[model samples]
Target: VPQDEQDIAGQWRTFVENNRLDAVVCIAAALRRGVLDEAEASRYQRPAVNLHQPWELSGLGQLHEAAQNADRLVCFGGD
Candidate 1:
């Protein structure tokens, strides 16, 4: 990854230590920022949910298809 992108991912990783899934959006931010690649994403099999509104989400439904198929980071069943 580029230095600047790496820097951004590093900062976000710090936040992940603090907020975990809430900070990283079920690994979405990490994936987008290149902090977690496809292989890494496939490793997180736990369920996750964010109660915030649709507009409040960052990459809303980016993982919906995968979630439906029982992949890592389930992203459904919210108001």
Candidate 2:
């Protein structure tokens, strides 16, 4: 994983452990890069917003896609 991803994972790990969050929202790239893992997602039996990034969509594309998927998945999103 890149240094930035490592940084994010480290920070989130601390936050999650400290607060015992019931869910997590993260970019799919982190999961694919191993920055985030299943154990983390399942730590609290919580749901995750694994935002997907498609090459076809540039800026805000992933966000839009995530929102659309969220609807299908019964999740919610905001601008």
Candidate 3:
């Protein structure tokens, strides 16, 4: 859905500026799904700890939460 890196970056920026989320957690397998900040590009051995968006998310908390709630879904197929 995001057309470019900046689109998500902008969303991340807006989210950080507006939400109450506490931390960012990237799924090891899916971390490559964009959201790359400056540090990740520079760090040769680490997952760019420095350039991470100041106070934003890093992964799809929605999908993961949905999967966790899969067994307890309602008739509409949603938790």
Candidate 4:
């Protein structure tokens, strides 16, 4: 994430945690943008990872699962 988006991401993470929400980040997209969780970072030999708890880096299957379980699903797209 860029410096400007860090705060927003933190806020979203907090909101998800507080609301007991599930957040599944598309692993391919995140990796393409240099966003990785601890496991991914280690696997890719990255010194650090920008993603943390409450935000899961996963595949589309997880998204499908979330949609199946959720009352409503909202998706955001980016360049």
- On TM-score, the candidate that comes out on top is 4
Each prediction's whole-model lDDT (CA): 0.47, 0.48, 0.53, 0.86
Local accuracy of candidate 2 as per-residue lDDT tens digits, 1-79: 6854568656656776677643434435455554434454575464763332211112346557766777564545666
TM agreement with the true structure for every prediction = 0.24, 0.26, 0.30, 0.73
Off by over 4 Å in 1: 1-6, 22-62, 65-79
TM-score: model 2 vs. ground truth: 0.26
Specify the highest-lDDT model's number: 4
Q: Against the hidden true structure, what lDDT does model 1 obtain?
A: 0.47
Which residue pairs in candidate 1 have backbone atoms (N, alpha carbon, C) closer than 3 angstroms, thus clashing? none
Determine which window of 10 residues in candidate 4 has minimal summed lDDT: 1-10
Residues 1-79, candidate 4: write the lDDT tens digits.
6765568767887899899987878899999999999999999999998988888888988778878998997666756
Candidates in descending TM-score order: 4, 3, 2, 1
C-alpha displacement of 28 in model 1, angstroms?
Answer: 13
TM-score of 4: 0.73
Pairs that collide, model 3 = none
lDDT score, candidate 4, position 52:
81
Better of 1 and 4 by lDDT: 4
**Candidate 4 structure lDDT:** 0.86
